[model samples]
Target: MASITASYPWTTAPLIAGAPMRLISGPSLVHAISAAGGIGFLAAGTDVSTLSENLSAFKSLLSTSPIPGAPSDVLPIGVGFILWGADLKLAVKALSELPEPPAAVWLFAPSSSEELGSWANGIRSATKNKSKIWVQASCVADAIEAIKVANPDVFVIQGADAGGHGRYASAGLISLVPELIDAVREYYGNLNGGGDTSSFPSPPKFVAAGGIADERGVNAILALGADGAALGTRFLAAEEAVIRKGYQDAVLKAEDGGNNTIRTDVYDKLRGTIGWPEGYGGRGVINLSYVDAIKGVSFEENEKLYKVAEGAGDKGWEEGNARMTTYAGTAVGLVKKVAKAGDIVRELRGQRI
Candidate 1:
């Protein structure tokens, strides 16, 4: 078995500091993860303005969260994007505008290996800084292809149980992670520099994703040969996650029956994100609208109800109807309280399971 260790300069044992205990992977969550010594990523694919503001917000938070006795140069956050819909130009613009570059850039929902290759090349050619490239993979083949083409610093294997827009045929992390590690090690040969394809002097770090909500999940992944775990659904329950309070409550309320989290094709079709692969799907709670729409009630036919449920119009925030079928994962059961990011990371690190 390979001994695991923290790869980057950042501390690893102290996970989750001031983490936003909500479902959204926003700035607070990012900073909390970084503060706790776990790498956090800012998902900035929503819009250009929001993305810019978020980056600025992250910087401000980092500046404020610095340890009193620690070094002044400590930065505790990274950034990521949905590879398929990523606005590379905008990302570049954000990076250039920022006082400093992110520690890493996570890429998910990639359209193809070629696109990842291009992205890696662009990132390599453009920046002289030390920002690592992290990519998410849904398949063994995808993982291998990405590692070879992009040579990402880290590869996150998002399993089927993951929330948000992951692959439809997503395998569980247990099966996929070790396979990916073995494949990587095989492809790269011995990281000790004896094998034929050993480009680097050491093995690249691999992070596990999906269903990783607590310490048992963390320890399991570590035992499975992963360097660490990338938690999403669990962190959504954190207090600082930028999501609706109602949604957070829903996650907490439904914790007992966490199996209610379902993977379906309805949202993708409704949201017009049909560009995804054929077998790919998403996971979320089955809501009234979702159940109602399937019974021969089309979006056009139920536009008003859908709008009402989705909180239509200008004062929609007041209506509070956008709770049904929101993205989540099976790990939602483990999330009982909306703790800070730092606390969650600490719990996971101290977890013996």
Candidate 2:
């Protein structure tokens, strides 16, 4: 087996970089992160070209870095996939072709209870090793189902404050993380499975995600029994993030003043991306189009306006029409600068908390 490096939890680093500690998990942001001793994951969405290129880029960067345990204590980077939308065949192919296998795998937006199991099985089949799998769970039921089948190495409890598409305007991270942890301990510990002392071990540790922008949030989650923390809104403004300049600029311009961000079914409609389940909406700084159609108008009227905006092309957002809906989370207010991904990681890893 090829030698791999151990993970350095941000909690352990001196300075405990709060604002920048969130891991950048994708091919694009990997260089910035690994350089900072922070874990960066490869975001494998539907774009195969970008994914392939980024994977190669990551390997090249890794080859130049000093290897861990070989006179250097470096850590290998990780990979992330949207379990629901990802092309499984492509994922399997990636596992085989990458120069160095990923240090970990994170699955996003999984629905089926058994999907995780199938994913874990496929990963193990391809690598034939104990590769860690992390799954994002939107609710207790989702968490329970995923733990039942996939039994991931880590579970990310995503709250509504998450920027991307998440559960219906239901639970927020402040409430969900502890709730999920409690639910896991209660059911998995003593009910149907083992009744508090059953033969099986407890479920994998939990991680808190959504609206975690600083070390204070990190400390809060850690106190809540979460093994670690995952952040999306905190990482979106990083220089390495794939979002557009205008979007990044918008994020930097805001302040934590009020509830300006909203979750709505506007962006997916604009982008024409499929497989988005209903009741769940995306949260971001509300734009003119979103405000006019989603917030101001009735459901029927909004639907009509949305269709009209979709037909207008690139002039949508700029013209107050609606071509592309901006994707962001509530933390946009707290984000101010578009620093390098490494800087972001360093900030988080080096936080005082």
Return the lDDT, model 2, position 128.
51
Residue 194 Cα positional deviation in candidate 1, in Å, after optimal superposition: 8.0
Q: Candidate 1, which segments miss by more than 4 Å at Cα?
A: 1-6, 14-23, 46-49, 67-74, 190-199, 256-258, 271-274, 312-323, 351-353
Q: What is the C-alpha lDDT of each candidate?
A: 0.67, 0.62
Candidate 2, residues 237-292: lDDT per residue as tens digits? Answer: 77777665555566676566237777777656655666865566777677665776
TM-score of each: 0.85, 0.80
> On residues 40-71, what C-alpha lDDT tens digit does candidate 1 reach at each position?
77777534446778777777776777632222
Error of 2 at 104 (Å): 1.4
| Ten residues in sequence with the least summed lDDT for candidate 2 | 14-23
- lDDT for model 1 comes to 0.67
- Return the number of clashes found in candidate 2: 23
Superposed model 2: Cα runs more than 4 Å off: 1-28, 48-50, 66-75, 191-202, 295-324, 350-353
